[model samples]
Target: MSDVFEKVMDLAKRRGFIWPTSECYGAVAGFIDYGPLGAMMKRRVENIWRDFYVIQEGCYEIECPTIAQEAVFIASGHVKGFSDKMCQCPHCKEFLRADHVAEAGGIKNPSTMKNEELAAAIASCTCAACEEVLGTVEVFNFNLMFQTTIGPGSQRVGYLRPETAQGMFVDFSRLLRFYRDKLPFGAVQIGKAYRNEISPRQGMIRLREFTQAEAEIFVHPDEKNHHPSFKRYADYTMPLLTYVQQEKCEEAVPMSMQEAVDKGVIANEYLAYYVALTHHLLVTIGIKPGRLRFRQHLPDERAHYATDCWDAEIRSERFGWVETVGLADRTDYDLKAHAQQSGTPMTVFIQYDEPKKVARRRIIPNMSVLGKQYRNKAKAIFEALANATPTAEGADVEADGEKIHIPADLFEVRDEIVDIRGEDIVPHVIEPSYGIDRMCYAVLEQSYDEDTADGEARTVMRFPPNVAPIQVAVFPLMTRDELDTIAHEIARSLHKAGILAEYDDSGAIGRRYRRQDEIGTPFAITVDYDTKDDQTVTIRDRDSMKQVRIAIDKLPSTVCALLDGSLKFTSLES
Candidate 1:
């Protein structure tokens, strides 16, 4: 077992965050139940994500159904291609992730290997389960989607959507019309995504069903370089892992967004802009700077649909530098595929400023004449003509699969005056997808430490205010009625003001503070007898163990300002 992971798991259960599901009957793998604290923490993290990508970024947040029809996956190429290789343990008959097992045994790029090669790799290896030599290992594809029947009959096949971006793709036309035919627009969906792992041995880092916050930004293919808000984050510095740097085995180099794009560490301004945003959001949400890096996805590891992909990987004691977020440039492949399969025009019409007159050859169909000649098929001929490009006709026309033998008497072929106003184009998508479960674990693991305070080793979680499960804990000095009353009142005030505050009075003041600190409450407000005299409370900084006095009336704003970093506890009275 990973020792650090085991420690965090115990801390999570004891502190009211996350625990295995159905513990009474026997715990289940790949499923975890969030406790009161965990649920609150998850919501808080998602809300902050909304602020960054949805609100500040000027995108729409949509809620879509979790169960999608099989056609959706077929159109999105998941039904055919979304698969992971699997191998079973011979002795125990337990299945394991094929590539992971091969890679752990020194096969460099197991994902790119063929089934025969995979089998060969496993043959020379011993199963981790029973240490028995794997014999004639079989490598087979396993679809990771969790399938379900939609209705009464088991006929209709449905699946838990593997991603949130597909809903956005399928809803593109409605959104386009709603936005009044805008060229560049974005849509986001934050919800659950599922992948049935064969074995989820890595604690919270891997889950069968997990929360995913994803953004899909659609733009004209040629216009991806000219992001309007590119300048806002151009100067922001980040740890960039350029493709070239990897070739030299160099460490991730710190550089500005401008340099990252200019140096080709990031593909373009649009991609760089979002990568910078991801970095900012991670840091703002309590991930330490040194523990985070942006790694370029090696070619074999990139999603099949992505042209360029990078991930925001965070370092954890349990899993070293795991991928918590993915930033990918999925160029118009999805839309094109859907458009072709569904027989719907997916391109947006980009209108020109002024209509242009162009001379082009046309099959001038006489409606009155052709209508009489082929009365029923006249409209069909016109449709075929409209869809047929000049080159397709080649001075002859095929109307509705009927070869139209053009004769001078039947129709006239000549250059005609026409107005061309706009052209249709498929919009390319850039996506930033995040895994909330992995990130939550990264936060807990990175912030965890055991420090000796007064000759006692104390475990504490140092979460930042924005994403911390509990922001502050309101503690009364003693269990006396008056102190408890004041503490309860103060806690109520904080709750009303949207602060997560806890009212604890049963334990000693020091013990209470320690308890709150253990769960990563940044500030603790202790109501004492001094509050009765001066009506001022003592606010203690959890990390520094320093205390200051503040008026009771100023508590809300003072705490609010401190939480946002606009004011410091040292500068303020508390």
Candidate 2:
């Protein structure tokens, strides 16, 4: 780990941000427990995400169970495809991800390699634990899903969802009805997703169980190039590292959403719009824009369902560039898979502006001649023949898993002109899947800073005002009866105004300010002697340490405006 990562983690654990789970009984590697402040900050991040996707974009939010039936995943291809290459260490018997080991051993893009290729790459690699050379170690695919039984015994199989996108796909019918059978609509889910990692060494970056906030936007397959809200992000420009540039070892270039689509860099407007939205959302949640870029997925690395994909990568001291959000154009893959597996029609009816007369072919079965040839099976053959399109010679149909051939005399084909008003189509999906845990870690790493304050070295987390866990910290200069009472009253008033305020009067005033600074509280209110005499107190900004005296009556509104970025600290009267 980098020194900065270690320092930030130490602060996180020391202060009640996050810590290992089951610490007293030897904590697990891939599990963590968030402290009070950490939980608050995580919720703030989620709420901000909700505001962007659900409220602003008008996507309906839905919650689904973490564990789903085996069929749910079988249809989604998770049972067969959701896996990682693993190789066991010869000396220590430790199972490690083969791709990670290959990458560490100077192999590039190890994840796209087949098992045999990965085994060859791991042949010369040494075990991270025992330091023994792998020497032709056997690499095998290991399924990552955590399997379980839904009801009793092992009769009904179930597994923890590896991604939240499946639930929205499974509930497509209901969501379609909710949106009144619209062509374009979105459903979002924010919940826990699980993956049984072989070896999770990146602390919070790689977890067995983590939170996910995903939005699955269903749109007409033909309308991908024209999203209704594309104008909102059409002119917005951001750094994009296209696959073509990546292959040539080129850097990301700033490109507008419209230009990316027009140049065929991004597949369509829907995909580019979400990529731009993801950028804005990450920046809003305190991720530094300079440290963020959207990288297009290489063809070999893209998911099986996606035609085009981009990952919002954030630069980190320890993990170079980590993928926090993935935006992909999953074109009707999920719905079609489920529909075929469940024997349900997952389609929407789109009405044409004007009804048109079209030529259609009709097949008529001659049952009277079929009854003599096959007595009991004639009706079945006739029914099957009615649905099959026959060539000039004959028609072939399947009945009870048996392919039956119908001679030209047994069926007749006729062409007819019919008026068609509408057609049913399977909608494509544009998904923005977020790794919430990675995002939280990114927020922490990017917000960490150390500098001199009051001629003393101090550590601080420079969280954005709206994204801070506590918006303001209330303090009394001393631990006196009158000071404590006034501070409590001020805290209560701020709370009533929906501002998260913490009242502190325990230690020295300087120490209290340092505590709030470390926790990323943007403002600190001190109720001192002046407040008792003149009904006014001092408010200190966390970033600049500048103080401004304001009446107690104006504290809530002032703090609200400051937190919302309407009022600037430098503009306040001193």
Candidate 3:
């Protein structure tokens, strides 16, 4: 960790934002507990995300078990491919990611290298902790899933889920039924996901267990270029770093969503719409617009199943640009894989706008000639040929792992026109995956500020009002009964009005305000001697440190309005 990271973490710990878990027993890496303020702030962030995906998008949310059967991951491809390259130090016996070691040694893009290349790079570099001349470096795949047993004696294998996406895929049939087997319906899941990191560093940026908010929007494969609500976000402009620009070492160019889709910069309208929504969400949650951009994933970097993918990267002082969310056009991969593995159809019946006659191929099988050639198997072959589309010359069919070839005289093929109403199709999925822990860290870092107040350096977190840990803080000018009583009353009133408020009366007014400023409390109400007579209190703004006097009855409404940006502190100057 760098000096800036240490400072931010120190303030977080001191102000009840976060703490290392199991500190008394020598805390482990990659894990931390959210303190009182952090927990409340995290809840608010989750709720805000829910508003965007669930309420605004009209998607239903579902809760699933964090642990799943091994078969679930096998179908999702997480069991085999979800791994990282790692090398254990011969001297210290500590395991570390091989790519990270190569990057520290001035090698760029080590993630795309093969295991042998990563091993060779590790051999040239020394241990990061100890400068020991390492022996031969052997890079190997390290699976990141936490394995467990569902029953006694390990009969049923299970694992802690690596993402919430698989849960949505597994519940496809149920969700399809809920949506009445319609296309373009979505399901979202927010829950804990576990990753067994080889070497977890970077505080909150990397974690063994974290929260993920994932939504899978199932749409017709042919309808990706057109959406019902494309106009809603078509005009929104964002900074886009295309794959071509990355190859040329150029910065992101500002472009509107409509232009991006029209020029084929983005894959389709569905992907572009979510990209714009991600920008809106990040900015609304207090991320600086200048420090955020959408970087398109290169063909080599994207998953095999995804046609196009982009990451919403947030700039951090300590860790350069970090990916907080991933939006991908996963076209019919998960659903098809699960259907093949589970033997349950995962498809939506898409009806045509108008029923019409379609050309059909009919196969007529000769049963009498086949009955004498293969007495028992002829029956199965006749049934198989009935459902198969035979050619004019011949056709091949397989049953019970045996290949059976039918002669040209055995079956006749003819084309005919028939009326068809609809057909079943595997819906393509557009996913927006979010790492809540990383987002929380980005919020903290972006909101952090340092300034001099009254000749002393004061640290403050200028978090947005919607996601602030404490919306308002109530303070007493002094620790007197007359002042403390009014402060508590004001706190209660604010709480009743659905505002999170804290009351402080232990120290001087300056110290109380400083404490709230550090935790990003937007508004502070200080009850002084004047309040007992006039029934008015002084409200201080965290960002400006400006104070305003308002009547007691109007305090709740004023604070609420200020938090929502409807009422400004400068408006009360006159």
Which candidate ranks first by lDDT, i.e. highest?
2
lDDT per residue for candidate 2 within 326-381, as digits (tens), equals 99999999999999998888999999999889998888877778888878888778
Each prediction's whole-model lDDT (CA): 0.85, 0.92, 0.90
**Span of ten consecutive residues with least summed lDDT in model 3:** 386-395
TM-score quality measure for candidate 1: 0.87
After TM-score superposition, the amount by which residue 384's alpha carbon in candidate 3 deviates from its true location, in angstroms, is 3.9
Work out the TM-score per prediction: 0.87, 0.88, 0.87
Clashing pairs in 3: none
> Which stretches of model 3 miss by more than 4 angstroms?
84-141, 359-375, 387-417
Q: List the residue pairs that clash in candidate 1.
A: none
Q: Candidate 2: deviation at residue 281, Å? A: 0.7
lDDT of 2: 0.92
Q: Residue 108 in model 2: shift from native, Å?
A: 21
lDDT of 1 by residue, 1-574 (tens): 3587788789999888998898999998998999988888888888889999878998899899999999889999898688888888877897877888887788889888998899988787778778787778789989989899989977999999988889999888898897789878999999999988767878788899898999999999999888999999999998788666787899898899998888777888889999999999988878988899999988788887998899999988767889999999999989998888788888899988999888987766667776888788878876665544444334245767778644445555567889999899999999999998887888778777777778877778887777778888898888785989998999999999888788888767888888888888889999889899999999998777788989989999888888887987678642
Q: Which parts of model 1 are misplaced by more than 4 Å?
A: 1-3, 84-141, 367-405
How many clashes in each candidate? Answer: 0, 0, 0
Error (Å) of candidate 1 at residue 68 is 0.2
Q: Which whole-number lDDT from 0 to 100 does residue 213 have in model 1? A: 92
Task: Supply the global lDDT for candidate 1.
Answer: 0.85
